[model samples]
Target: MAERKAFHVAVVGATGAVGQQMLKTLEDRNFPISKLTVLSSARSAGKAVLFNGQEHIVQEATPDSFEGVDIALFSAGGNVSKELAPEAVKRGAIVVDNTSAFRMDENTPLVVPEVNEGDLHLHNGIIANPNCSTIQMVVALQPIFEKYGLNKVIVSTYQAVSGSGTQAVEELYEQTKAIINEESYEPKILPVKSDKKHYQIAFNAIPQIDKFEANGYTFEEMKMINETKKIMHLPELKVAATCVRLPVATGHSESVYFEVEQDGATVADIKALLKDAPGVVLQDDPDNQIYPMPADCVGKNDVFVGRIRQDLDEVKGFHMWVVSDNLLKGAAWNSVQIAESLIKIGLVK
Candidate 1:
């Protein structure tokens, strides 16, 4: 028997929420790692991170950080990814970026492993992880698209506060506590932190996730729309999205309505198809009041799907609910899965 080779892995933004989850997912999966390097912004450098019960000190990320790294999972921010991802690639490392920096690039593959693992082969040393809300929705939709031939998709996301980052999550908690105690609290982070205005995100839903574009869609919504088309390889596919931030902390849920090209596809058929779908869990027993929800989906890697039914008005339209841990499947786990797929297909050695 031949010995399986372990590679040196580097995690950028090791101190952030998604970065922490990346390390945990790598450990939980027991990924073969000959060495692990945790990198972060200069402010977070020297912070201690524990991986597989061993403490690893985070270093300031620079062009030199990718030296000898085989796989680099990046989640710092778009600007950081823009600057460092190419550097990592230049250093002979394959980067799986969890930011929007490279997703829309014609040369880069926007990948959700279950949907477009094969796209890794065409990668120019970097792979873009789709938006968190897009990841879970597509995971649930891919099987349906494959079986019935999808034509159009409309998704409304109920995303978690954690998707905004740990600061937003903390703001939600602080505001909720203050509100419950009849105290006043100010909103600081949400609906686009850098935007001039911040809105309350506790016990309320913000209809915007990211900055709005000239086309009236938020960046987050546009991400879902564009990334879905790219991953499904359906450039002509019609897709629309409305992204909202809810008080939930970890999981992201989406109400997705899609139209299929094939006629006479029944609800029963969709259920059966998703029952065996890879990286998906079918929980569609509405009789018992079962469905995918954010609270119940925290910390899980698989996308949970439920509430599948045909639209009453349109013969080709069907609606379903999709849920998954935003930090895991949406960011960290997907990045790791991309690395795994690269190894499985011999793209990385």
Candidate 2:
């Protein structure tokens, strides 16, 4: 094992939404850094970003950019990560990729730190960060899965516009103002920008997040389904997701219905379990109107769980609402936490 030292850190796509969050998280978490490199596309190259109160110029990412870098955090895009992540790995950097590029790769570990930090030891240089929606769900589900064993999970997501990237957020803003002004405007860059058609996200809920798959599930929903199984090491576990994009700017919420192998599970039992679970905040009091909301969860790292109840007829079925700041727990913060785990577990040099 290599002796732990302050690392030469690189944040690929340092100018993007998640990239900005990653930089902020690195600072907030006090990650040990001997040097920091910020990389982006040619368009963003030469742009300056501050790290540790010092200005660093963003450079165009290339295979050689990983030289002397101990850990590379990638969130540019799938194509960029697909090309550069292997290069980063070849240069002796452990890549914590925050894209869909290598997520489904059998050799890649799709990890939620709280759920599968132990799996990080098996990395062959690249470790995947799970989808923003998937990360919070797994964190909340881990304790329950460990204690009672999960048989099924069906999640309906109320996702924020930011998940679509910076442009989508701006579009929502403009569209909302347009709707209020009763002005005619065109709809683009929504419900999959490259798809055949676009829909307005102003004061509306879009049921699809990513492009539709041949199996009828949107790519985003499939990511939640498939990534959950991979991270949990439960290929046989039944999982399904209906991902919806709401008009909110931050945080992702899910109404999750699940079945536990353990019978006679009560609402109180689940509450007690989550109350002590790592990275979970329990707020399930219906009478007082207590529950997790996306607006209230913004900037928070903990996954919030509330609205716990047993199914009306099915003894094994239980439901709960889970929420979290997607940018924090979902992307940047989780990626940084994985880096921290690498240090704590002595995986990074």
Positional deviation of residue 53's Cα in model 1 after best superposition, in angstroms: 1.2
Q: For residues 73-162, what per-residue lDDT tens digits would candidate 1 score against the true structure?
A: 999999999999999999999999999999999999999989999899899999999989989988998999898899999998889999
- Report the number of the highest-TM-score candidate: 1
> Per-residue CA lDDT of candidate 2, range 1-349, in tens?
9544799999999988899999999999888988899999898999999887889899999999999999999999999999999999999999999999999998988888889999999899999999999999999989999988999999999999889888888899999999999997798889788899999999999999999999999999999999999999999999999999999999999999999998778889999999999899999899999999999999888999999999998898999999999999999999999999998898996
| Full-model lDDT, candidate 2 | 0.93
**TM-score for all models, in order of appearance:** 0.99, 0.97
TM-score of 1: 0.99
Superposed Cα deviation of residue 296, candidate 1 (Å): 0.8
> Candidate 2: minimum summed lDDT over ten consecutive residues — where?
2-11
Question: RMSDs, each prediction?
Answer: 0.8, 1.8
